[model samples]
Target: MMQQSTIIIILLSLFFLTGCWDEQLLKDVALINSQAIDYDSENDTVKLTIALVSGNSNEKVPTNTTIVSAEGKSIRDGRTELDKKVGSELFASKNQVTMFSRKLAEKDIYAALDGNYRSPLSALTARLAVIEGEAEPILHAETENKPLISDYLRDLLISAEDTGAIPSVNLQNTLTTLYDDGQDIVMPRLKTVEQKAGAKLIGTALFSDRRMTGELNSEESIILLLLANSKKGAHRMTRKVQTDEVDPLYDYVTVDVENMKRKLRVKKNELGNFEVQIDLVLKMNANEYPGDDLYKRHVIKRLNTQLSEELTKEANIVLTKIKEANCDYLAIGRQVNAFYYSDWQNIKWKDVYPTIEMKANVDVEIIYHGIIN
Candidate 1:
């Protein structure tokens, strides 16, 4: 009798575990791959768009792709409006990219992103980008060739980060930087171009106070990436140095940077003013060093001097650009907070950030010359 009771209890437990109460089959659900948010300034409404992947596990090729959009006074409201068309609850757990329209970014995106931040299903790791034009076009363009636009954007962002063109900023990091008192934020700026090849990532957006303050060109964006310590892969540095009597007047040297370390020091001057000093240690391998003489002290010194000068010049240009844009990408305010907490409290970071004197010293070490000496 006890054995029979045990078997019956086991059968009942198995029956209770057999059903997935809140789970839907793959066929019954639409997989959301990417999302776009746009602001209609004239209509004073927020537009939310989602891209749904149309493919089955057994199918070798995707049948089609679909983009659905809805507009309302807020992001949540816009999502509710989208329910009218989707007919099912939206799921963002698989979302890979989130594109914000320029208009929406220009007006403070905090209110628009409240829904994403509050939602339990939303992904904090989703890649964020600022769309140059309309967000819907990016979601809709080349849908036939690219089954899912979100996956494409994700790959593009990963490539961009590897190439050091833009710093990788996910939803969580962006929000943290924006909310932190000692730092500002930046996002990859993406634009679709009319080219025979196809669309591509163009630039990056600079943000100040949770708004789109300006944009950085490709080169400037790379420099910003380096300054922000976001560079992960190899970055090439080209410098022209005046040669001696044996070589040409100028020889171009291409350096493959392997590693870079940056240290920031903030201190108060005797006059009570603040000064910031940046020290960078870089390790590099020479890709193209045309000089016949190798391991010469003068040659190394000359190369070091030229590299230092060029790097300082580039760093100053980037700093000036960010200052003009009114975006503090370097997080100079963090230094202030670390060294002079009391003074930072008395002074407004934005007001005094532009006036702070900065000095940069870069030291580059040539570790190798490829396979050669």
Candidate 2:
């Protein structure tokens, strides 16, 4: 009789644990993949757009997605509008990317993203970008071979990072830098091109204190990332060095950045202003430098000198742009505060950055050629 009672109790326990009591069915919720936010200047409101998977996973095949937009006084308000319109539970745990319009980014994206990061279940690691114009259009842009706007843009950001064209940025790290006094931030710049025929990743957007300041092209961006010592993967460059004016092909040289060593120092000058000194040595492999004798030491020396001068000129131009925009992508202010606490407390970083004198030098060393060399 005791054994029979024990078996009956075990059967009852198994029955209670058969299924999850609070499992959310896919058919009852709309899964959000990507989102865009724009500043409605005319109405003084915020516009929010969301691309979500249709809420019919069990009912039918969900090949099509529902792209919708709503406007309200604030981001959360707009989110509420979307949820009411969709008429289903809005789930965004799988969100891939968040795009901020140029206007919103320029004004200040720190406030615009508050709704996204406030939730503990938010996709904090979602990649974000500053659209060159209204971010909505990119979502609707025509793509013959691409999957969707969000997927294409996410892949583009990954490609840029792989080539060392932009620093990897996500919603979490951005918030940290946005609040930091010493470090500014940078983001991927995306734009629609040719009457919305396609979208392109033009370069990187420079930010100062969470506001977009300026931009740098793909080539210039790689150099900037290298200077920051944030190489994502393989870094490659194709430059038309001053090799031969007659042979246009010979003017082009391809190289791979194998390694780099950067040093930054901050010192108070005699004029009582901060001057930063940056020195970088880049080791490169000569990939395509034809029409020259690779076996001869003298020829290699000339190539090295030419490349060094050219890269130095480009690096200085980049530094000038950074100063003009007052974008501290290098985190120089952080270095100062960590090492010179008293000096950091006295000087306002925003004011000092624009006028701060910096001496930047880049030297290119071609340590290896192909096997023939």
Best of the candidates, TM-score: 2
Candidate 2 residue lDDT tens string, 156-232: 78777787777889988888898888888989888888788877888888888878988898788887887788757
Put down candidate 1 lDDT per residue, 61-178, tens digits, no spaces.
Answer: 6656678999999988987898889956678877898889898888896786777788777788899889887877787666345455676779889887886777888877777787
Question: Model 2 off-target regions past 4 Å?
Answer: 1-23, 55-62, 243-247, 371-373
The C-alpha TM-scores of every prediction are 0.85, 0.90
Judging by lDDT against the true structure, name the best candidate. 2
On the 0 to 100 scale, the lDDT of residue 83 in model 1 is: 82
Report RMSD (Å) for each prediction in the order shown.
3.6, 2.9
